[model samples]
Target: MVCAAMLILDVLSPLLLLSILLPSYGCRAADIPEDATSEFSVRLYHQLQAAGEQDNIIFSPLSVAMALGMVELGARGASLEEIRQVVGFSHLLPGVEFSLLQNLTAALSDDDSHYVIRFANSLFLQEGVTFNPEFLHLVRKYFQADVETVDFSESAAVAEQINNWVENHTESKIRELLSAEDFTSATRLTLVNAVYFRGSWKNQFRPENTRTFSFSRDDGSEVQTLMMYQQGDFYYGEFSDGSQEAGGVYQVLEMPYEGEDMSMMIVLPRQEVPLASLEPIIKAPLLEEWANNVKRQKVEVYLPRFKVEQKIDLKSILQDLGIKHVFTSNADLSAMTDGKDLYIEKAVQKSYLEVTEEGAEGAVGSGMIALTRTLVLYPQVMADHPFFFVIRNRRTGSILFMGRVMTPEVIEPNDHDFDSM
Candidate 1:
């Protein structure tokens, strides 16, 4: 099973507005199709890696794609083509991509008592702008986005309203996602997506077994972190780099959440190889191979309890991925509205993820018993160094969250100031 990440996308433009929030899921390798969402995940990961090297990087490609997909509905000429190419939608017939997205969203958002998941989208239009009825109908039908009119002249009030909506949808995990400066009299539309998920481990980590461990960083230094330990049967695999080059072998392990529908895949390189060496080889095919080949085995696992929060401006990254027209003077979005030069002014995303022994708080009970009868020592999979991880949905084959942990640290909830914005 694969675990998908939560993705949020917001598009700010002078005339056209688009926003998307989507939850992540993972499909079995055998079930995955050569579709736009699947292809876009791989391509966008590489682009993000190249743009932000060595620092902690995490954002949802699906979120960006959904936001762009909404934009595509109104994009014409070069703008549409560039978005389609960059998002890998060119391979599909017109409208097929959006239909697939709608189905995927519905499938992922299906209720589960074992998990808490939320995905929502909305459009905040300038009070006086005239948006095409066709565009509104498509967004409401396919994306289920709520459309509301607000006065951009009252920038602070608008920002608060948008942030309040985001905070409510995300269970307050993400607050102040937008600022007063983000809106102005010239701003015609703002589109937003918000997604939040919390799930428990199928085999919950015992709090008593948690202890401080040495975590090695990329720069050769080490830090002490609280690591949770568990021993269970998990899907595991080992991969070898076929090249005569210095890249060595790596281990992959999949830990399922309580329902066994979603999982976290961890890729750990051998001590001799740095995570940087492994990044170049990560692609959809290789990921699929790992998922298909992993076998169930009793293993010892040690993982750090950590949290990550990130905010990113996607304009330059999209530009690097050959999505240039939408942000420039040549943009043509006549399908959204008439007589307005509707180039995207900003594209931003904010994400937050926390992994703890209790899993997501309200979703699961805490009691779990460990098997102590094994006579032989199980193989160990220690995340003592930097490693890559993907949260995927097994049923849908979508990745909800993906990131590399170089220096794992616990972030107290109160440490972040949401009111400042």
Candidate 2:
């Protein structure tokens, strides 16, 4: 059962892209409790913050959890327990996380009229390898994962086939997901999970109101970008750590998508304060508090259309999180196969996200607010500087994408319209 493994998880949304891959050698269900997964999401974010520094961050926390759940299906002993502890599933009965993952993903993908969400899970095994029947059955039952047999010796062809499958499921948004170097004759199994979502805003931004504006980066530099402006009723709040720490006062704004089941929550610091000063105060409880306290009110918003992409080495991050058994030679994956030689070789995640002016087709904005520096008529969320954001399911509290925007879509100086500003 010893083999090199690659697991890939992909996410696509209005703010889009992330992919991850891990494998092990078993079998294993409940509704996943809301906020049960928050611990893992927040920990992953902190790890990313430490690793990425000031780079723009983006990855689907739910997507990564699902991929791990698939791996947990075949994991046993310490390998399985490590995942449970880190993923916050230790409280559940031995196998309930699988059902929880299925339910959470199902809830998000069920109502497509308001948004487009698709989940694709698959398993690719080397031909002629005998895997436990129970393992395959449970994976199909809980994840509805399609199982295939591939010849890993032909690394290039295997990479091409897997990449094509990823592209097809993601509406062609993510391509070249795997390379020939990622696979070899020693590879045994590769797990793949892909999630795609596209939704329009409930109050869509009018494209005509977009103008070139100056964006300040944390590094003390400025860039010109397309800033979308609007005045509408939205979930807004102002909060602080009750101390001078975290830069005095900060703002939280929740902008819902078409159905309101999913929304992008932006946390902005004061213009004079840097985002780094505010990052340390972020925790799981703070996320819930911000969500609960926001009030619906009219707001003036100037949000830049931005794109962020990053490739993370999950092997290092997971190791840092205390999930080291599966990646070591002492891995216990006997539940997935009858051999003691099975273990995970490598794991990686790459994510991409783009925020644009497009939202729901027929939805109309309330009105446009005039750009002014001194007037404070309404609680305005001016995202002219670096800020953190999360796109999650409102009901399930499942984080679909989490990251920060330091540099927005930068345009050349000639691209700016001084007259419009």
Q: Would you list the C-alpha lDDT of every candidate in the order shown?
A: 0.68, 0.74
Query: Which candidate has the top score in lDDT?
Result: 2
For model 2, how does the per-residue alpha-carbon lDDT over 1-421 read when each residue is reduced to its tens digit? 0011237321110101136311100001013357578878888888999986779987768677877887898889999999999989999998988878777766655653467766788888878888899999998998888999999779899889988888777666666877887776677777877776667678777877776778999889888777888889999999989987789999999998876777889999999899989999998889889999999999999998777777777777888998998877777877777876777766777777777666422222222334565777899999999999988666656677788999987767564333234
lDDT of 1 by residue, 383-421 (tens): 878888878776555777777787786323243311111
Q: What is the lDDT of residue 109 in candidate 2?
A: 58
Question: Relative to the unseen true structure, what is the C-alpha lDDT of residue 401 in candidate 1, on a scale of 0 to 100?
Answer: 72
Please give each candidate's TM-score.
Answer: 0.86, 0.90
Q: Number of clashes in every candidate structure?
A: 27, 15
* Model 2 stretches with alpha carbons more than 4 Å out: 1-33, 111-113, 359-370, 416-420
